[model samples]
Target: MNNQIDTLCTESWSCFKAYDIRGRVGEELNEQKAYAIARAYAEVVKPKQVVVGADIRLSSKAMKAAVCRGLVDHGVDVIDLGMSGTEEVYFAVQHWQLDGGIEITASHNPADYNGMKLVGRDARPIGENNGLSDIHKVAVQGHFDNCLPQGEKLTKGCLSEYVSYLVSFINPDNIKPLTIVTNAGNGAAGHAIDAIESQLASLGVPITFIKIHHEADGHFPNGVPNPMLPENRAATTQAVIEHQADFGLAWDGDFDRCFFFDEKGQFIEGYYIVGLLAEAFALRQQGAKVIHDPRLYWNTTDILASSGGQPILAKAGHTYIKQMMREHDAVYGGEMSAHHYFRDFAYCDSGMIPWLLVAELLCVKSMSLSEAVEKRILAYPSSGEINSHIAEPHKVLSKVKAHYSRDAVSIDESDGISIEFEKWRFNLRPSNTEPLVRLNVESRGCQSLMEEKTTELLSFLDR
Candidate 1:
């Protein structure tokens, strides 16, 4: 304990990332560090009352306890939500109108890693631009002020209300008989799915749920629940095929991001999902304003334009997307990365809401998931994001910019360098925590052109 305190007070914390706190257990994060972080958060935000939760990682429980202890020690009341996902913390903070919240999770990271996501009032993320840096400073120094009257601690559960609110997004009457396959990947999504399943049954929505790996196991018996990896997707796709379900959904460990697979066991890229959801919102509320990231948004913009919706572009990140959603009062905002934000949900992202909305759309449109997104996919063929490692990202970016500027019709550098032409467009942006740059190319109604441009852009890295 003494050694830990000395280390906390003397050393800098490498876990403080740009948007959230995340690192390997023991080496970068531990119980002591978690406590210091929570205390620092308390001193910085000074919330009267805050909610705390944790994912099913082995280290999460200990981390959450330390965090709660620190909060209470700083005279900040703590509301323990028990074992929950990142979005649940966001919901509790916003739904209960609490001062702040924290969820101990690494969200798709390996089992040896655990971290925390912090949010302020109304669940606004506490990123570097906001208050996370201040928290880091206090935590690293470990020079907290003398303890005041220790705040009380309490326990609460909001799963039922949260599921009810999610189901409220769609009319049960519109939902038709369907069979759906859900791959929880042994994460926290199963709990939410079970609650939603019961709610749908009570509402007389005749839908069958085929669940796989539907238990919270920190051991991750079936590997991590990250659907982004091609290897990790085969299980859900195979399950969808074997069950002959209408569609399938999968979520990460924290259940903040959701991924979809069609009835044919095809993994639909998230780029198409954004356009599908944008069209859904536009049809429901005519001329609805939708926010989208700058990366690979031709399909989204085209759909919004045709659907009589206004398309607003923001930098590609959850923090920026949520902030922009609030600024424009956008009804919905989506990142091709599968983070969906809604205005009614306190401008926070929810994995459960996106799937429900998509399911309802399937019933209302009388279309399969594949059929719903087929046209959009064809209209804008995209070379899903490709990443390249470069020693000096700036020099390569400069070269690419100079080379492309001559033929580029327009260039926007809001988030990264997005250059557009009459037939195709591409966005190149540096990774937040690596020497890599990500590139996404899309062409209007031309897969071959999109592929050609993607190859051309990738070759720039070799130069």
Candidate 2:
């Protein structure tokens, strides 16, 4: 046992990141390390009953089993929801009132990578500050105390219930008959979409779904299943244009974030979707509080104000956003990265709910998705997040601040450095998970101004 522990501890703990566990599958996160992580999590969290799920990764099954063994060994009963998106585990934890939950997934990483996302009761994320740090420390130590009697494992299928819960977010009768293209990117979203479609059909909802890359292939034959990348969006855009669909939708590996494309096959910036959804929820319940990240704002803030809702700005990560949502009892929260959080859905982000609400909005407004977003797009044009790899992100940020602080109308450094001028503004922040610095520029109804500012910021950052 000592020799085994020594071997496990020798592996790099880099897989345990700020928000969740993630790394290359074999080298950094094989079965032994997975077992150690689960054991460490069990020791730290000490939950009586936990829910576990995995994405359709080639290594996920083995990892899942190893995690379950560690949890069960620690006398924690495990509710296994086999092959699921991260959101499913979130749903199961809250819906079933489990003590905690863990989903084994690397979420849109390459096929060679796999990891885990952990949550406690009510689906609150276990992040670095909250519990992930302790987990990392204990995981590195690779030591655990075994229980006298191992806990039993059980399998639970929540897809039907999960689909039903998702459908309840919007009235099916209000969803108009429409042709839509959905690109699953050959990940776990296809199955969820299928289940939702079945439920919609049962309710007599007339919706046409043109599915692309629908298979859950762990090999990711169609690239890495990430829709954020421009190159990855080509197939979905082309399919939407070829099918002449109303709009298009795409999801990453674990389907936590969803992306949208207009009828013209133009990729809609996620910044606009945050405003759209905020407006939708605000109109449904007037004066509702909406939470938005500080990265890209004006549009969302304007929409919320115009719709008689309060806008609260939170930090840019899921963990921070979820915490803010609960604090303010916000109706919804969104990040420009396409993660949408619903208070009704236990403040966890869902790729599924955003589209449902958007579809409902299209029906009620009697407009195409493009028409719905066109006004907002023109009102607040933006440069979608531009990431630059830099050795000294902080130094570059300071340099940019020094250049603009003199002329800036307002400057804020809550998550990153955000400088505002009269007509245009930009935010430059280091990524929470990666070494790159992300820059976002937006102007008040001025596309050219946004372009100029984005280029200017890149010039400073590139140096």
Candidate 3:
């Protein structure tokens, strides 16, 4: 493959996306580029040791190795966690008491793409405003003096610890007998699922798993493993349909964020899952606050409040949400985009947590996933999430805001613009990574008004 290193990145650095870096592999990222990034990262963080992991992508393993080489050259010790997800690597960083960590995966991007997500000592995000700017400058230079004459390499695996902690959160002993379909999408989550399922089986839980595409096929012949796409999720949905399973589960490339498909072949939003988790956490830590972003639904707010946990809203990004969880000492936090952070796990988000919680919810209660979500679905009907491209982003946002920002209702620009009304509210914000704007509308349990307001807003955009 052509290495894009030792070259000027003139593509507006859009590849350095919102929360982490991702792009087309050859054109945007390659070994040379990864080396510079790793060297730059070593210089900026100056961490004594860095933990590394990657997905099942063919290039991901090499990309991670190159990064380790760069770090070791920079006189930084490397702790290699072979074949793991992003969150599992993050947990290793915390569990190992290392300085920071790097996860070599492109998240849900296509097979041709790959990237990295960096974290500080506490398993925090290194966003653009944070240390990313310094790292970018170092990467641009592609030369570093921190390269040591020689360094040491340590190989360790966090799979067992990660699985132990996840099982600790829920009792596999109490798990109910249920037929479930889990789709790993040929990513790095197979090993993890294997270990966890073994534990479940040992506990005598009758979880009949109809596993789909569980192998680590880097070719991704079945398209990107991102269940967010209707096409990519077809296999999981089909499994649920054919097997008549209780529900379907899906995870991204690194398994940090999970997606679900109900038995009826319907994709469920991450927002509702947040509410369900809030319920679980509340039961454990009564009156503990839950953090949520202002997107799609207020189900989180309602769930936390009814459960006696305070609900605080933050901007919709991993960095912002993580900071909020720390500030408020929240028991849990979630965004509509499927990122869920937990204070119990050192204020880091885990893709494994949601599935474990789902299993526990099933084991403890007699309710199906759909049955549990019925009341909240009726309370806050949303327009899901809509994305639109605009040549003039600022102008369009201002136009939308001008129409509502000055109204009698309260307005917020925390993450985006949320013009609140008694019966309906809408949030419009530009995405940090994509060239499109994100729009969400929800009503106070009013279906007609939601349709009317959504139509009106789209009409405005149409004009």
Candidate 4:
């Protein structure tokens, strides 16, 4: 879009996708770009102080240093949180009362990729609508004209406090008897969860835990920690079956989202998890506001509606939902992508909260993970996200919309394009995280209809 941008360099800036920034490391993302973003970000937010963190990417330390340099050079006091997950940076910004934060990560992207997630004061995301585009424009201009008195970079070791904050949220001792298998995929979550597990034990809850790839090996020898991928999640499910564990869990590279596998080695739909969290949050805060994406479960909507909570449908992305949560003072917001935001926790999405909630659900229900999730599946049968890659994702969406929108009971473009019928609903949205338009469908107590719609939608999406 920047026409006069001759040196508008980097690996295509594909990292600047729909949500946050992400791209391959040496190829597109590097210290120069990181510094550029940091300088521009400080100019926009005009923060007196900012917290910064980085994942375990081999290139992250240098990139983080570059980011800190940019901030400090612009008279922004830098509270370097050091190496941490994306959520930890979010935590430090609010928990430590910093003005804003930036986390260097590519999340589940391959080891060679890295990027930054910029936030405003109180850990709010800086999307294109808010200020990220301006930051990008500044970075592209390549010359920062606004340089104030150089500030200092101070180290803030808040991982201990971060661990404490997460532990305090859940009744660790009261957790139900259960077994959990998780693969951190050699990301920073391994270190954080290991610390939290100790806290859980101190609460007198003896949880049987099995962890695979529980080391900060950014090499990702076991593959990226993104459970959204079938191959990446295969080992996790197998581990659950092998141990007969209550459930299997996995996190992204920086642990911003959590995914689950039932005791039967089945991956539970993220929509149901959103529903379960909504009920839990509503019970604690009566008549609270809850936000949900309209992808897989109308049950989440219906449940929140009946649970004495106000249900609001949000566009399916972190940027939109978090702002809505803060505006409405929502107790919680959830997406089928497993992103969960808490109003009390600075309105930032967390990968850790869901795991703690699931642990509690196991204790309270006296049932295996499969048994607990099976009820929801029966309530709204789903067609798991199926993706098809073509030259043009929009062309495919347009074609699918032509067929489904004619008799549509409801139509939505919240995430992608969603068209609803009397008894079924399906959405075909291009993946910001990938190169395909994902198709997810659910039917109201009609397995056959669910299948029929799923087949038809996939057939169309595939083209």
Candidate 5:
């Protein structure tokens, strides 16, 4: 290995994770490293043109500039989308027919963190198994051949087109006139929400939007925009109750994953939302196939079966979900972590489309958001994902498997160890992003049983 590559590997290989590149801004990831990675990516993918976008992180601009420079130096034409969400890069690549795309974003990570997500033609992901590893190898080498003619760079705005496409997912005339609360949590979501609201007004849709933390502040004055945390959801939940809104919505830093709230100020789990959206899409296109992650299963599978739709289980991750959706030509795919993928959207996950579909579902069904998902929740009670930071995750998984093997009616390890019994099932998998083990348990119409299994599993993992 080259001395530079040796240095990077020894010092800060933490930036290169399983699915995407992420790390602390200046310490682990910097402009020079960003440039090296982009050059390596260009060398590996050899794309004629690439779309580049950045989030509102303070370091994103410089990082994006370095990446663009590297791509341009390699004779790859660059279409810069300026500050944008991760999905915008996906949209731009497919919409503009670019050869590849890159988004400089760390999603819901702290303000001090930043990263990059890459996609090939058709917005196909380049994760660890495919091109990311190659990029890492080439990046560490840090050597690039000279190009006689450097590539050209052009800047463009994609917000309007993206917003129009988002609104096209649902019929504006059929949507009910309801007040909805939206919290951007001071992330990049504010821009898209504002644009969508403007487009809705122009189309004369009588929807009222209540906004909070609607500014793009990198300091994260409100908190990181991850609604998965109970504390971070209080603002959106409270706003829904105070404004008497039909429902509430929030998005992470890059606006790729969105979370939902009910009319009664209750936060909805992403697992149930998967079922709800699956049913919605199935109602529109009968016999449509829906893809879901392996972490939580019963609710989504049951809903798909009842809706006359095919349900496919994919290993959990954006790259795997998108690849499976394309392979099966599935209409929609969702993960419990709020990543919702659509066939219509280049098989890319969007934080914007889920809430739009939910709103339209409420309007057409004449049911409140709570009422829409209550049946599914009661039918399959889940102990939302519980994470524990343990030193020996693999050993713990092996122990858990050994303990449950005999009792489990069926066992599988597509993504992790998933054991199923007569009435309940649980999945214990090591997290890809963090040093932790994530546990997800669900029961058949038994909340108490779900709780019991969750407690038991926690005890086993903790011990």
Candidate 6:
């Protein structure tokens, strides 16, 4: 087995990323790589038992089987959670108190790509800084124990319990009669939605679902389920408008992040959703702590202040957000990228939880999604994140800072350059994986100022 790994893996693996493993299937990530990664995880994490699941991608099952084989060969017991979302693996790990878990998914990447998300006990993320680097090293070295007894595998499920757990976030009885449009985009979200819908029906919650692109197809006939893209959002928006629904929801390939659209088919910015969820948490528990990314946060901070919640800022990405949440014991954490994390769910993000809470908030507040966020949008108008490609990202960041730093009220580089003024602020962050810089600008009650600043930053970056 060791010789097989050494012969098969002659080159350094390219699938390892800053947060998780992801790459093109055949060229970068294959069954052999998956097997090596699994063995590496067994060696590094040393978990006695692990839970594994795969998304609907065509390569996922084979990747998952290779992973399982490696784990079993390492004498690590495996719990199989056949075709499921990334969050399901998270749920299974924490709910069952397993040692670790992995989900075979590329998560909104193109059809030709596939990868994995890994977590340890309590569903703690295993990213590059923590354990992923070590795992990568071990996989490349191809060293393993040859004396341990082979372990066994078991097939189990938690769909019903997972549905119940999702429902427990909100009082189902409080849900008012409403029509909702849900677009799964041929991802793994459809099954979970169906299960949740059935559970809500059994609980007598009167919510009608108008589902579109709700089948699991690895070919992605409707396109990849990335609602974050402008082109991918039209179908979900049109569904809401055509159905005359109260609101709409959408999820990515692995269903870890959820996106929302208002009744008027206008897609809500994820920043506003963060504010809404922060307010909801604050209302539920006075002085609740909330974690937010450091991109565009005037509205989030303002809402937290008025709602009596403490807002903690963290660098963007799941691993950093989860660490900050654990550090502060925050009740909830949100990223403007539609990732919502909760304390109750082992500090893990869930595509299912965010929409459920938004639905309940709608019923309780008796306001449309647009109405709920309109005032905040007006008060703290923002330029949604805009990405610009650059050959040298560091030079661009330095130029932006050098230009703005002297007159800036304050400058922060915890994540990237965040320059603040009395009335407006902007964050220019370089991408971890690509030659791009993402800029987000916001101004106090000044949409025009935000737009002007956004344009100015882009123009400067282009130079």
lDDT for predicted candidate 2 compared with the true structure: 0.91
Evaluated at residue 54, the lDDT of candidate 4 is: 92
Instruction: Estimate every model's Cα lDDT from 0 to 1.
Output: 0.90, 0.91, 0.82, 0.83, 0.91, 0.92
Q: What is the TM-score of each candidate against the true structure?
A: 0.96, 0.98, 0.94, 0.94, 0.97, 0.97
Please list the Cα RMSD from the true structure of every candidate, rounded to 1 decimal place: 1.8, 1.2, 2.6, 2.7, 1.6, 1.4
lDDT of 3 by residue, 410-455 (tens): 7777776778887789988888766778888888888888888888
Tens digits of per-residue lDDT for model 5, 1-463: 2775567556665789888999997898998899889889999999999999999888999999999999998989999999889999999998889999999999988888999999999999999999999999888777778643799999987788888999999999888799999999888888899899999999999989999999998889998888888899999989999999999998999999989999999999999999999888887788999999988979988888888999998999999999899999999999999999999999999999998888888998899989998998999999998889999898988888899999789999988899999999999899887777899999999999999989988887778
Candidate 2 vs candidate 3, lDDT winner: 2
lDDT (10s digit) by residue, model 6, range 301-394: 9999999999999999899999999999999999988899999999999999999999999999888999999999999998887878888888
Ranking of predictions according to lDDT: 6, 2, 5, 1, 4, 3
The Cα error of candidate 5 at residue 320, in Å, is 0.3
Worst 10 residues of 2 by lDDT: 140-149
| Each candidate structure's count of clashing pairs | 0, 0, 1, 3, 0, 0
Model 4, stretches more than 4 Å misplaced?
A: 1-12
lDDT of 5: 0.91
Which candidate ranks first by lDDT, i.e. highest? 6
Give the runs in model 6 whose Cα sits over 4 Å from its true position: 1-3, 7-9, 433-435
Report the Cα lDDT for candidate 3: 0.82
After superposition, which runs of candidate 1 have C-alpha atoms over 4 Å from their true positions?
A: 1-6, 389-391, 433-436
Which residue pairs of candidate 6 clash?
none
